[model samples]
Target chain A: MADLLRLDRDPAAALRETAQRAAVRDWTCATLGLGESATVLVTELSCAEPGCPPREVVIAVFAPHAPRRQCRIHCALAELDESRVRAAWLAPTPCGGSHD
Target chain B: MTDTNDKVPVTVLTGFLGAGKTTLLNRILTENHGQRIAVIENEFGEIGVDQELVINAEEEIFEMNNGCICCTVRGDLIRILGSLMKRRDRFDRIVVETTGMANPGPVAQTFFVDDDMRERFALDGIVTLVDARHFGQQVDANEEAREQVAFADVIVLNKTDLVTATELEAVERRVRAMNALARIVRSDPAARAAVPVDSVLGIGGFDLSRALEYKPTFLEPEYPFEWAGRFDLAAGRHELVLGEGPDPDMGLALFPAPPVEAEDPARVAAERAFKWFAEDVEANAPGTLLRPAESLAILDLQGTGSKRFPVQVDAPGRYWLVTQHLPEEFALALHDPQGRPVRPGLERAFAAGHTHDDEVGSISLETEEPLDPRRFSDWLSRELQAQGASIYRMKGFLNFKGVDQRVVIQGVHMLTDNTTLGPWGEKPRRTQLVFIGRNLDTQALIDGFDACLAD
Candidate 1:
């Protein structure tokens, strides 16, 4: 549950310290541009039951760039099921076109 | 090592002109893709390589040669192989970039004929780069174009970005008719698929024995021989047929017109007819009268012998330039405009270098010194450079002072990149350069050639 509060470890330690110093003012919310500076807060996530995933969730006090970032993440990862990749792996090419 | 087991691999990079063959070559060098590769460039441009330094010293630019006229022994190609055998550790692959007009048969023959070369290097198949845009036109003009396709085991339908789907399909069909066995990959040099040099070379692009299993038919295969004169014209000889395709019903005996020997009196008659054709084409076409090529025919480079050469015609795509040369003795035969029996000792030259085959009316000054095993090659290369624009292809057997065997110098048109083919086990001989061109001047060329003589 405590691990959910941070992002992945930076390979180059240089950017880590930059992120660390800015954390005093609850920087993750500001970096995400999710809300007004005063409204955002860093809070740990609690499971509805005893222990589930998302042990921490930075609730979006605001979400200005939500659509754009969500779409980009979806494209790169394509975990979203709508992609043709989700279709039958061996689907034959539709040869129904009027080739004439 | 006694070396019976040692084998050399020859890799061929072939493509229609402007199909990014050079672009692919540059990437191969800059990336340091693998072992050392000797690049043979078939050029449409003057600069061989713009880079300050290229990896392979054996890399050579092919201008034009009279190989089409000379014996198909390909002595120069063998010599290049001889040189490669010496620097066994220097290069891993021998990449031969054939002229746009090349047939590839003679180049391949080099691998089979020489026993020593056969032992050292094996044929590594051909990688053909096809200009997806003009693929149809190139394949249609002459069987040589089709031969390039058939010989290739891998065909890169390059410049895919420039063509529509229909155009690509037509090109694909023509290529398929010529070669069904080849693996076709469509790409632009910018595409990542084309980047990995191994993708093109590592794939077996050609199989000679397989190519021989072919049947050529002129079934109106959507032949594009009449494509606009304007296209990407690389330096090499083109066989322009005034005669129709052999009638299929006539069977095997229906041979095309036997090439008129330059020494034959009939060759003079053909040259006059060709000259009249050029003059008519210019009068009708007007301003484009060979705008790209500046004709140079002077008893002296000075104004006296150097006439305003209006008879010469440089076609669009800057491809073929037709010119005429006449021997001083046959001057009278041409003075009266005769399709008559009086022979005119003239010569015709094309992109394949000089051919003084017809000495009566049209003379093609063939640069064959390099073809001879007796001449000096480096000197011939220098001579070829001076008469640069007029050259089609030149192959010469060379000898560097320190080396005991022969080295081959192969040149194509304005692309002066040449490779050291290797050393001859036999005594060093004169470098032979077979020059094929339209209206090429042999004597004047010889004078320029004299200058390239080794000091």
Candidate 2:
């Protein structure tokens, strides 16, 4: 994804990334079998720490009574596919999420 | 990353109970700063007396969950900031008042750990108010008091008139020893946390250059060895006599000295000594011969009498003797083979192992070598996972192999953010990291960082 600040200067790019984020949120809600009460937040975080990808999409699923479930895809929001999201959420992960 | 100029600046206020947090908050609101400022107050108890004290601001309190159990960010803060951004033109800056018992780590980390918050807000600085009259007792009795001082960028010593001049000086010295980087400002006792408004506000404590622009002594790390002496010796055996004192064992290292005219000779010798200290110790009983080698030697001084350890000098040259503890502590002395006392031509004492609080202190590690990126990331992740609960704050500038730009990392507990500031250009490439926390193992941190060095 483009730099957050740079996207501010380029409105078209910002709009595109925002739309992609919304699409990811919808996909996460569907794949997780979340109900309307569940809050699904999809955010793209950029990290410069060594061994970390340049950008990753973090999907946090907060259900009504269950614990929060989070999964990350080491790619930009635009590049994320439905199958990848489905597999990531279906795979058994640790209590919080797979930080790797 | 967001442009700092476009984001709203936030100044966090944290201090112990009875410290002038509310006084400072009221002072900021009444002062003619020519800006509309919003205040966010976090009260500890159910009574909520602070909200009534604040003026000319809307009081909105929201309680929510911070998703992950280990994460410390207040969910209410995230919701409040999100709501405030909708009416961005209503305010120019923000000031958050944390309770006396609150740790400022979570409050500061919220600006960086959250994606939306990171883009919308900039943590300008953390101004800690310290009550001069009750500082000694509060710091001694409470851990939160010490943590607030350790994490402050600007410390306002309030209520100066309540204590004598000598008491104020002692408290200032103690605070300085605990945190060498904070800019200390004395407030008017009569005015109640009143100082120049510019001193607390507009100070870019989180900015890299501004954060590192404190005293030069802050860049100096606390050395492991306390004393180092330069001695010119002949190619013969020398006796190191030690009288019983504190511990049963003493760590020592001898290295060939660089030329006297060499630039930064002390630092040069220290670098070698640190590497040797990190290696496995060669344990020697009393009366055992210690030859000049590339490892640290541990002399066992178990008995209650003077112990003699022979040190062999293979070549006639100047050598440096570094001891883990001060020579005065153990009555350590050296004698040449001719039975003549050899006085050191040069002696230096390192500022080591002196802290305001025993459990809460800071560890600084510095190296000129560029670090391996992958190894550094792995080591940091593992460390934060294991010791995040105790680590209050961490900040550093690193030189990573294959990366030309300098990497700036700032972290609070488990959440960390690393960003490229700029290219190295003409400046020397170096990695400096400072960790402020409780029960920190200095050797373990040093060894872990050393392992990340690029081969």
Candidate 3:
């Protein structure tokens, strides 16, 4: 996802060890609303950089409220993305869509 | 202007996001019978799918600079269109696609104001599209929706296939309230082009014909207004109205009327008193209350014809808000340096204690248990007379103590008449009056509501 942001200079990078099936479950359980006790699987991850095992993992994000509920997280994220884009494209308008 | 042979009429295609504006534009571009068109897209905010849309000539996108279009439209629109006209052969008719939230004034003005530009580009009329699913939500609460309709030469109620007959009628009812002129067409873009380019080319002024005329009467004196198209108001409760109608005086009169500068102690003091207004509304309602769009129009006491002053309405849970002025009176006030309530009359009206030694506009607020419609209207009439406010329009739903049903009262000062909504039921939750006047106490009217409630 950071690749999508395409920010400057430092260029985001990260690392997390345990690179195994068990490690993947723990990380995802915490992230995917599975709670610490739930068993995990090799659902998602990658090792694009090579040499290093695929440390990055994937888990379902839950709603801030109604915890553990699979609320439309897409709405929240979509909202931010929607507004961010509208704001970025704005310049001088010939005026708003209003009239006398 | 250039002869019809060389210079083509520039049409502005505008409306809310997902209102099929681009879809319609794409239709015109890809399926046109025979006409070269160049398209320009100006988004309200940053993100834009202009690249995704099509046209014959190369496209250009202008981001609203840091300032507002009202303040900077002159410079920005000119640069884009001025350049477009330079590559005359590349395109024939120029179509402008505005961001769903962007106003269409500056865009329209590009033709009206500049001589050289005017000579080359003709004002082909404003074509605003409405989403059938969310037209009601957009028009009832969204200032942009009303603006778009008010100034439209042609309106495309796109997505007619998605809405119900009853809901579509409601959209037309509301649209009639805001605008008396406009040509409306129910369109399924994929099936039929909303309006053939020939019918649209060189069209000017509002076209008063469509899905609106046959519907029931309105709450205003205009009776059967020029209803053009029908749409779905409840289609998408989640969607908000995007584009406003076209503004002629460059955007001086849209809602959130242009800001009144602090030129002297008087204006400065007045502005200071109202400063808390923007922040307070935003704080109180959170997402439902504050609107950055209205921020520009509200701050002024003297009105600019550019924008509508911001007004708030509590409908169900969502605020059915607008800045179109209702009737009222006015009295000038002496203010304090801090812009607090210093004048006794100003203090009493707002019921606000703080005073400033500055000039503030004042109006009388009189409420009685019986709530005489005639008498109350008289007080209101007197208020408008005293303040000398150009009351463009006024409407409200009042539930009186004795009345069994709710009362719908509306007036367009230009028409000099108002109609009372009958067959009222349920006492009004609260008696509210909104004055969308310039340099006047919009807050004062809201405050009067709390004090003037049924006793």
- Candidate 2 chain A least-lDDT 10 residues: A1-10
**Per-prediction DockQ scores?**
0.01, 0.06, 0.01
What's the lDDT for residue A94 in model 3? 15
lDDT of 2 at A73: 75
Candidate 3 ranges beyond 4 A from true positions: A1-100, B1-6, B43-74, B189-195, B205-455
Question: Comparing 1 and 2 by TM-score, which wins?
Answer: 2
What TM-score does each prediction get for chain A alone? 0.24, 0.76, 0.21
- Per-residue CA lDDT of model 3 for B1-455, tens digit only, reads 12234556778877887887766766676654676767766643222333332323212222222222321122344445545554677666777777787656555544533234544666566788888788767765776665666556667777877766545654554444344345566775356346565545556332111212322221112211111111111211231211222211111111221234333422222233343333322112112322323332222333332222222322212111122121011111112223332222111111122232222222223233435344354455445444423332343445455555444443322112222334544533434332322245555454534443444
Q: Largest lDDT belongs to which candidate?
A: 2
DockQ value of candidate 3: 0.01
The interface root-mean-square deviation of each model, in the order shown, is 36.4, 8.9, 29.2
Least well predicted 10-residue stretch by lDDT in candidate 2 chain B = B56-65
True-vs-predicted CA distance for residue A6, candidate 2, Å: 18
Q: Which candidate should be chosen as best, given TM-score against the real structure?
A: 2
| lDDT tens readout by residue for model 1, B1-455 | 01223566677766666666776666666566656776544454432455432223222222112232211233345445554455567666767666666656556544543233455666666777888877767665655565566556677788877776646655665565444345666775357226456666545322212222321211112211111111233222321211111111100000112244346433333333332332222121211122232222111112222122112223322222222321221111111112222221232211111222221111212232333222334444445445543443433344344444444333334322223334656644444434433235668766655554433
**iRMSD value for model 3:** 29.2
TM-score of chain A of 1: 0.24
